[model samples]
Target: MAAVPALPVSLSGRFKGSFAYFTIKDRLPQILTRVIDTLHRHKNEFFEEHGEKGVEAEKRAISFLSKLRNELQTDKPVTPLEDELPDAALWNQYLDYQRNLPNGNGEPSWFQSPWLYVECYMYRRIHAALAQNPPIDNFDVFKEGKAQNFFESQEAVIALCTYFQELLKNIKDLDEKQLQEELFKLLQVSLWGNKCDLSFSAGEDSSQKSSPLQSLENMVPYILVNDMEKVWSLLVNAKKNRTERSNVRVDIILDNAGFELVSDLVLADFLLSSKLADEVYFHGKSIPWYVSDTTKHDFNWTIKQLGSANHMWMSRCGINWEGNLKKGVWVFHDHMFWTLPHDFSSMSEVASDLYAELQKSNLLLFKGDLNYRKLTGDRKWEYSVPFHQALNKFHPAPLCSLRTLKSDTQVGLKPGQGEQIQASESEWMGELIFILRHLIELQ
Candidate 1:
């Protein structure tokens, strides 16, 4: 793919006299102030631990963040300049889109550009925040706490793996109808897990704790399961039909860790038990990503969670889940494919590799908010645009996006549904949940 264009020179003027002024004047400054404070708090500790090199790196990071904040505030519009990474291209695209929009009344700033732009900008700002802060600057604030928790719970990881192995032992005994019901239960558990993710909201009351699996319980029944069932039958009925050899693999683009991973493991186990897929491949982020992304250690920690005798659900499932792991029917991988920017250009560049890996799978299940944002190219689409159209042919496998909308950019809404949502709810675009399934052949 050719290089993306630079940010337009007109963006500064576009925001200067408009209501969107908060983005520059208040929001950006507030973010910068917090960043600087975070940096100052950790500076001494970072220096003491790493010596001169750490101190110098922290200083340079702080300087860059300060300069970037100043650039945002300046009267002179800054056009895009090349950066060391392709992620910069997303910001450049945002600037271009925002500058070119026809000014009109009642347009929201969040809807003025593609979803990818705002999501990428948030990530960049988070990166800036870390850079400006010392010891914390060197660490990913999102992942550090989670990683620490995983390391401290080694026993939990082993037990979960053992449970999965045992679950596999009972697969041959389940009838088709029983298998379907079991799979639906697991899907419900996976859907509910989205509620636990912190990105959605910071609790207003310190004492209130949100259920991690709430959304799943709400969304599972709404899933128009005719399609999901058809897909399931296609995989499971292959032997009886005898028309072709069935060698199906299901890929789960994993989301959070802890309970979320446990829910996903439950779903994976069901898929194998139902004969919906012979094997399951879990794809995880390569970097410390969106708070609870699964690392190698987290993967092990999740397995342990599933096998523990004290885990009420696992004990009740009455299957030896651990046997599946030992048989190599379940596998885990962390790949760089996830770390790249969400754009058509980036998707196209990586298509060949993605296709190669996914060619072996019958279905790819992308979970949670960030994965959904990336899959849709994070662009603000006309509410009527078909979900497949927004994907821009990036489907490497027949895919199901099970997401609780945390950001905008939804497609496939029924006529007037979008408008009705806007009228009734202040933040419907980000609060609604969806299970958008697209078959490669359907496109």
Candidate 2:
């Protein structure tokens, strides 16, 4: 067994009362209830599609989800998955790893293990239950909520698409100054769009309040550590130093499903139309995850939804996006590795193929809080620890984590910056702090 590094910040600490504890105690069960509840409402549809056998599968799936909920609420042992997914063995192996921890009773329990591990395990367990039962195996319990959330961001979607239309129309006319301004604006839009995360609000639609592109100046003060200039330089240097702009590739490891997705698409569109990247690759989850992580369904659905919307600019944006896919300007990929619980630092060893594929990109953008956690290994590092050290040599390509703070694990702050931010304790308007690998700090 790999020597487990310093014990992670577990949800069930000695006293059993951190946010992680609260999540397992309250939030996670609530999410499962909604999953089962959605199944209940769709019971007849399952019967309609799969006959009596489908009905039986639906009942079994619901029961499994309910029982899963019970184990979490009561803090029972996390049952290792029994399945055929390639990564299933790895999951089971980690369960064994946790089982042998100093305080473990030769078993992994919900509240006692690393919060990130067990929390991720719950979702994979749900997938396993469904995979074992047919017809329902393809059903996403969260599909309804995801689609509704997408529609709910209609106004912001229109405004953003309209902004894309305006800026992209004059792309060739813009000088470097104008080009950087547009890229920076869209980066903030993509970063702040993360605030609308459904998982953070426990599946509620957190809509964009006003025009995302119009709000950047007001958002300046909220960014605690801005490495965007360095990011810009990387892109600019790649464009100038490379033989052709089209050779540069930008890979975005996406997050969320609603407005956040739209923001990512808009930025991707800019990268392509402005020639910052020859091709844009988007990575999404292969299964339902963290309530709102992008999956193949969510990615296709958002693009089709935008392309076919009633509004003009919105529809045009969608149509253009469709054309981009058809022409191969934008490529989409989903790897099982994404849904696995391993921190990115384990990428080269555990998911070497993905690690190698990422090396092809000129730059990689990891979006939102969960991705940020995986990037930093979710350790309880002293805030001033240099960011590269926290990455533990996970660099497959030059990368950036554009995340809003939603979890307790953070690093790369200047001296005392962490405590100062904690003392204010104010609800955020919205914020985006990009943590770079300090090893790549621009001279």
Error of 1 at 87 (Å): 8.1
Point to the candidate with the largest lDDT: 2
Q: What TM-score does structure 2 among the candidates reach?
A: 0.93
State the lDDT of candidate 2 residue by residue for 166-189, as single tens digits: 887789999988998888888888
What value does the lDDT take at residue 251 in candidate 1?
Answer: 91
lDDT of each: 0.57, 0.80
Clashing pairs in 2: 307-318
Could you tell me how far off, in angstroms, the CA of residue 121 lies in candidate 1 after the best superposition?
5.1
lDDT of 2: 0.80
Which runs of model 1 end up more than 4 angstroms from their true locations? 1-115, 121-138, 145-172, 202-227, 237-246, 295-327, 344-346, 436-443
Off by over 4 Å in 2: 1-15, 101-106, 244-246, 426-443
